[model samples]
Structure formats: C-alpha cells, structure tokens
Target: MKRILLLLSLLTIAGVSAAQEFSGNIALESLIFSEPGLDASQMDDNITLSFKPKWTGEWNDGDDAWSVEIFLRADNRDEGREHADIRELLWLHLDGDNEWRVGINTMFWGVTESQHLVDVINQVDQVEGIDGEDKLGQPMIHLKQYHDWGVLDFLVLPGFRERTFQAAQGRLRFPIVVDTSAPIYDSSDEDNHVDYAFRFSQTYGDLDLGVSLFKGTNRDPQFDLGPGIPHYVQMTQVALDLLLIADDWIWKLEIIHRDTDPSAYQALTGGFEYTFYGVYDSDINIGSLAEYSYDSRDEGQRGVFDRDLFVGARLAFNDAQSSELLAGIIYDTEKHSQSFRLEGNRRFGDSWKGTIEMQVFSNVDPSDPLAAFEKDDFLLLEIARFF
Candidate 1:
C-alpha cells in the first residue's frame, strides 16, 4: 500500500512538471467450472473485477522518461486471487547506443508458443492463470548496449517475489493446499538474495537468436511434501531462444540448462507455425502450429509438458473489430493425458472488448503434474472497458 501511494505521488508530481499521458482499463471476468471440484470447499463459479492504470511522463526531449502501471483485482470467491501489483514503475534513459532502466519492471524472454522455457526473470503469478504466462514485476537495474553485431543486456535484480497460489476454497487448485506463509529457501538471505543475468541477442539473415546466463535463486519452487510449503533453491542457468522467419513459416525454439544443489537438468521446446494468407480467397488468415517439449528428468519430477506435443490453430479476421482466436491441445506422449485450450477475443466498438477462454483436461495420469487438475475443466468470459 505504501508503494502504491509513493507511485501515485510520483505520478502526480510528474504530471505537474512534464508532458504526461494516462490510460487504463477496467475488466470483469467470470469463470465457470464444468464439474464440481475435488474439494468440497471449492466453488463452481467465480467472478473477478480488475483495474489497470498507467501513467507516463517524458522530459529532456524524450531522452529521459518514466512510467507507472498498476494492476488490481477483486475476486468474489478466493481471497488469494484478490491482489495488487506494480507491473511497471521504471525510469528509462537513452543515450545513443546505451540505455539504462531502474525500478520494478516486467521482462519476457521466449520464442515457442506451447511453453516459455527460457523466461526466468520474474516469478509466476500462479493464482492469475494456470498457463504460466502471468508474471509479477521484478525490481532490477537494467543496462542495454546496442551495436552493429548484436545487443547486450545486463540485469541486477535485488529482491525476489514468491509465486502466488490459489486458496483452499479456490477452484482449479491442487489437491493439497499450498502453505505459502512459511516458504523455505536454500540461501539464508531468502527473498533478499540478489540475482544477476546477462543476455546477448543478434539477428542474422532470417534468424533471430538470443543467449542468456543467470545466477540466482530459481524462480520455480519445489514443494516439500510433508508441509506442502514451497522451497526455493539457488542455481545457475544458461538459456537460448531463437526464431526463424521463412516466408509463410515461422520456426521457434527455446532451450535451457539449469544446475541446482543436487541435480542438473535440460529442457527444450521447439515449434513451427505455417500461415495461409487470405484462405479461400477471403480476408481471414489461418495458421497451423505444432510444438514438442522435452525435459531431462524423471517422470515424477518433470513438468506436465515434459515429453509432450502441442498442436494448435490460430485464426485472424481482417475486420474492423480485429477478431482473433487460438485453440490448442497438449498431449502427453508417455502418460496419454491431454489438455485442450481455446481463447478468442474481439473488440466491441472502440471502448469495449470481449474475450472467451476454455480449458479441458482428459485422461490425466497420476504421475503427470496436471493430475490434480483433471476435474477442473473451466470456461472463462471477460469484458473490458478501455479509456
């Protein structure tokens, strides 16, 4: 709360002194479960109201700028889902080929569609979604240098954010409630541990490549079976991501090798998407996607995506509403389990937008990580008003 007040105060001061821009959105979301949850305490339906506000100011003829974005959500059923975050509160300075940024910020790094294997900068906001796409902001000092050969980035991260989990009464949650109050850590500094990362990215012809190195506390935590508390470990990781653009085809790959206290493992996700422009002589474009994921770990220790295949389709309607849809299914090769997902969105006039999302799980094996969610299939509908 204090941080939010400080951010608002800064924005108010900036608005009085510099050129500023403000924008935001309010969204209402409804989620319905296909079946009753395994736990009797879980609810079959849930509603959430969310607000996101952003403010930006520029001075010195755009050479120096600062921006703040805040996200807040209120959930009817789960207190864990009701949260607030400073998605971005940063100052950026640019001078020729050098750039510097400091504050809380969100960073994304990956190329594949099925999963993001090389993105480890921020902690996952698990209560937001199960897809692992939502992330919490990280406090960091970022430096970038642009050169003819490539771009180099260095990050000094000071604080760590623990991943959020659903409450015991929340739907789409694990069988055992996660006790996040007393998380264990490998480092005595715990959440105060400092982390560092460096990345170099370059484009050669049709291929764009990035390689990164990180030494820090692992973003993904393992569960202590006895207490059901999350345990963070210190580790070093090397990651690579690449994209190749070929006419109507796009190929993507993300690979990572992480070393921890007692073990080391490598994982990779690779995929390709082929697009058909103006299908059937219409304004609609269709894309076909296929991806494979692998992990070098035991079956029980691996993630749901380990040794899995994902096939999906993307549709784009070149209309005034800018409608788009994506549907995909991930099949576990060894376990014979499947997860189906569908997402679509369309703008209603200039100020309103509507979205639909669905997820279904079938034949989940007990050994798979998603076994707990086998009966948690759900459909979500959301509407947002933008200013």
Candidate 2:
C-alpha cells in the first residue's frame, strides 16, 4: 500500500510539471470448474475484479521520459489471487543510438508460442494464470546499443522477485500445496543476489536471430517434499531464438542450455505457422500451427512439456470488432497426457471487450506432473472496459 501511494504521489507530481498521458482498464473475470476440486476447501467458482492504470510523461523534448503502470486485483474466492503489482515503473533516456532504462520493468525474449524457453528475466506470476505467460516486474538497469551489425542489450538486475503461488484453498493447484513463506535458496544472498544478462540480436534476409547469456539465480524453482517448500538454485543459461518469415508461413525456434549446481540440461521448441487469407472468400484469415518440444532432463526433474507436441489454429475476422480465436492442444508423448485450451475475444463497441477461455485435461497419467490438474478443467469469462 505504501509503495502504491508513493508511486501515485510521484506520478501526480510529474503530471503537474509536464505533459502526461493516462490510460487504463477495469476488468471482471469469472471462472467455473467442470468438476469438484480434490480438497473440500476449494471452491467450484471464483470471481475476480482487477484494475490496471498507466501513466506516461515526457520531458526534455521527448529525449527523457517516465512510465508507470500499476495492477491491482480483488478475488472473491482465493486470497492468493488478491494481490497487486507494479508492472512497469521506469525512467528511460534515449540518445542517438543508445538507450538507458532504470527501475522496475518487464522484459520478454522468446518467439515460440507453445513455451517461452529463453525468457528468464522476470519471475512468473503463478497466481495470475497457469500458462506461465504472466510475469512479475524486476528491478534492473538496462542498456541498449544499436550497431551496424546487430543490437546489443545488457541488463544488471539488482533484486529478485519470488514467484507467486496459490493458497491452499485455491483450485488448479498441486495435491500438496506449496508453502510460499518458507522458501529455500542455494545462494546465501537469497533474493538479494545480483544477476547479469546480455543479448545480441540481428536480422539477416528473411530470418531474425537473437542470442542471449544469463548468469544468476534460476527463476524456476524445484520443490522439497513433505511440505512442498520451493528451493531456488543458482545457474547459468545460454539461449538462442530465431524467426523466419516467408510469404504466408512463419517459422519459430527457441533453444536453451542451462547449467545448474548438480546437473545440466538442454531444451528446445520449434514451430511453424501458415496463414490463409480471405478464407472461403470472406474477410477472415485462418492459420495452422504445429510445434514440438524436447528436454534432456530426467523425468522427475522435467516439466509437463518435456517431450510434447502442440497443434493449434488461429482465426481472425478482419472486422471493426477485431474478433480472434485461438485453440490448441499439447500432447505429451512420454506420459500420454493431453491439455486442450481455447481462447477467444471480441471488442464490444469501442471501450469494452469480452473474452472467453476454456482449459481441459485428458488421459492424464498418474506419474505425470499434470496429474494434479486432471480433474481441474475450467472455463473463464472476462469483460473489460478501457478508458
């Protein structure tokens, strides 16, 4: 609460001194489960109300600027989902060919749609969603340089944000709840550990390539049994991502090699998407996607996508309403488990939008990591009003 107040105060002061822009949205979300939870404490339905506001101010003839975005949520069923975060609060200075950013920010660095194997800068906001796409902001100093050959990015992260988890009463959770209060760390510095990352990206002909190196505490944590306490470890990672664009086809690939305390592993995800314009002589576009994932880690230490295949389709109605739908399924070859997801959204007028999503699990093996979610199929509906 204090941090929010301070940020608001700062924004207010900046707004009074310079020309500022303000925008935001308020959303209401509802989730309904298809089956009962494993525990009696979990609810079959949940509701959440969220607000996100953004403010930006430019000074010194647009050479320097400040941006602030805040997110707050209130959940009716799960206390763990009722939280707040500073999505972005940073000051940016732009020179002729260089850029500098300091403060809390979010960075993304992957091209694969099924999984983001190389995006390790920010911690995952687990309570926000199960897809692992949401992230918590990190405090860092980022420097970027534009050269003739490529673009160079260097980041010095000073503080780490721990991953969030659901409460015991929350649905879509593990059989044994994770105790977020007592986390163990391999480094004695714990959350104060400093991290560094460097990336070089360039485009050649029809292909874009990015290579990155990171040395720091791992964002993903392993769990200790009996109490389900998270254990963070120090590690180093080298990653590469590529994207190639052809007439109507797009190819994406992401690979990573991670070196940890006791073991090392390599993982990769590669996919292709092909789009057909004016489908059926209508103003609709359809796209087909296929992706494969592989991991060299042992079964116990691997994630659900270790040896999986993903196939999906995307539909876009090029209308004034901006309607779109995406549906996909991930099939685990080793465990024979399957996960299906569908998401669709449409704009309702100019200021309102509606979205619907569904998640289903099928043929989940008992030994698989997704076994806990076998009975947790859910449907979500959301409505948002933008200002």
Candidate 3:
C-alpha cells in the first residue's frame, strides 16, 4: 500500500503544476471451443470492464528530474476460473530516458511456444523501457522509460520463494507423484496446479527476456494434452522480438527459448526444452503461426531433448469474428515417435472468445514405459474475455 501511495503522491505533484487527464478502454467477448476428451458443454459468453484516470508532468527541480504514471485494472468475468483478479500497472521515468515499469503484460508472453521468444527479448532488452497504458489502452502508466534515444535500467529480485501444492480438484494435466515410473505424471490426481514460482526478468530493447523457475499449480497452469498435472517445472525463458513498421505492411520476427521439468516431486527433476520461432505480416491480423519445439524425458533417463514443428494462423473473419489457429507436430527422437496438435480460437461479438484444441500422439515403442499412456488423442475448449 505504501508503494501505491507514494506513486499517487508523485502523480499528484506532477499534476499540481499542470493538467490532469482521464480515459478508459473496454473489450469483452464470449464463445465455446472443443473440450479435450470430455463432454462438450454449451457455448457461453461473458463480460469484463476496465476504468482508469491518469496524470503526467515534467518536474525539473534543479538537478532532480522526475515523471510518473499509475493505474488500476479490475475484471469480473464468467469464463475466468479465479472469478477475478485486480492488478496494477506502474511506470516511472527519471532523468532523460531511464525508467521503471511493473504489471501484467500478456502481450509480453503468450501460451504458445512460438510466441515465447518475444517475451525473452522483451525482458533482456527492456533495459528499463515500455510504451504502456491501462487495460483500456489509455496512457495510464508511463515511467518515461525511454526518450528520443534509449533506456537505462536496473533489476531487484533478492531471494526466492518456494511452495509445494497438489492437484486437489481440477483436471488440467496428469498428477505428479514424488517419484513416478511413468512418462506422464499420475493420471488419478490430474489437475492444473501451481506449486511455486521463482521468477525474474530484464529488458534491453525491442527485446525482452524473462526467466521463471517454479513449481506448477492452479487449474490455469495445467496442460491441454492430458489432465493438468501438479508438476515441478524448472522453467527458463528468453525472447527477442522485432517490429518493423512500413508504409503498407508491418513485419515482425520473434524467437523464444524454454527449458522445463514435467514432474516436480521426483528426486531429480530433468525434463524437456521447447523453442519457438514466429513470423507475422504487418497488415494481417490472422498472421501465420509457425514454431519448432521439442521435449525429451524417459523412464530411467531423467532428461533428453527432442524437436517439433508448428504451423497455424491468427485469422480474423470480420470485424465481429476473429480466431487463432495453431497446428504443429512433435517429434520423439528416441524411437522416432511423432505427435500432432490442432488448436483454434474464435471471438464472438466484441467481448468473448472461445478456444478449441485437440492433440494426437502416436508411438508403439515397447521400450519406453512412459509411452504406454500416450493416448492417440485428446481435446480442450475454453472461453475468455478482456475488459
């Protein structure tokens, strides 16, 4: 709370010398996708809202230079499993182009491996910079992290926090026992659970990089292939994205790297590493999706590395209809096994979006015990809204 107050005070001081501005944004959607290997439910839509007021100023107190921005975002929607979570975005700039920023930036990292590199580069390149606003897209938080030239920054993350949780209720992925003899976690305790998160990130330029070392938890954290499992994931992420704006088209190139452990309770947690490469056209909304990802983990072999291919698109049918398509193939290196996936996202009206996903795994390797439960198929569906 003190930090919030201090931020408000700075905003007040900046406003006293000049003017105050108020603005907001709203976007909501609803729809339904295919549920993974379960009874399909009826389609549904939801609502969410965001409001913000902002104040900005240039204070030149002798050698003391300052700038500040503060904002608040609250949302309520039926599609959300947590119901609601109110978050804040704070940005402050000092001297010329150096600044500070804090908040949840979804455009930072996405659910797919192809989009992962964008987050990493954003972290490593941030060096302290971002063009940000409230959930409404209004200029709510601005730390002047950048000026005409570049940015200056620092990172502060002292110790780490650790927690061990269980998949008590939901079913997002397989359950992970302390030591399991199977490739997939135990299916009985299937639920997407978030155990703990030890994360840190930094920025350089058009590049952002973030690293999170933690256990998995929450229904939201589960995998779509199987019931979400409560696994210990030692995750590391790096992303680099470049956006080029031209007269008629925009060109974007991004790369991401990730290494994760599928099981947490095991004595030695060694798992798979997935990498992504994404390219999008400047003028198209349903930009193409192409990615390369791989994973390697076996019975006695705690870890190995495999590669996969991804292809799809973020297609928009019209002003009121929008959808994203993600399709790819995963390659099992050991026995040359292979898997394929099809994921779809659709938006209804302006406030609701539905996601439908499906996966098929194929392998008859008798030597791999984990391959036993590799079902030839699976599916998932979800509805999400933004305000």
User: In candidate 1, residue 327 scores what lDDT?
Assistant: 97
Ranked by lDDT, the better of candidates 2 and 3 is: 2
The C-alpha stretches of model 3 lying farther than 4 A from their native spots are 1-95, 102-112, 115-153, 159-175, 178-290, 293-305, 311-319, 364-377
Q: State candidate 1's TM-score.
A: 0.96
**Which residue pairs collide, candidate 1?**
none
Candidate 2 least-lDDT 10 residues = 11-20
Off by over 4 Å in 2: 1-19
Candidate 3 global TM-score:
0.42
Model 1: how far is 213 from its true place, Å? 0.7
lDDT of prediction 3: 0.35
- State the lDDT of candidate 3 residue by residue for 140-212, as single tens digits: 2223244343432233321111112212221121223211112233223333222332333444453334333
- Compared with the true structure, what per-residue lDDT tens digits does model 1 show for residues 94-119? 99999999999998988898898888
Clashes of 2: 0
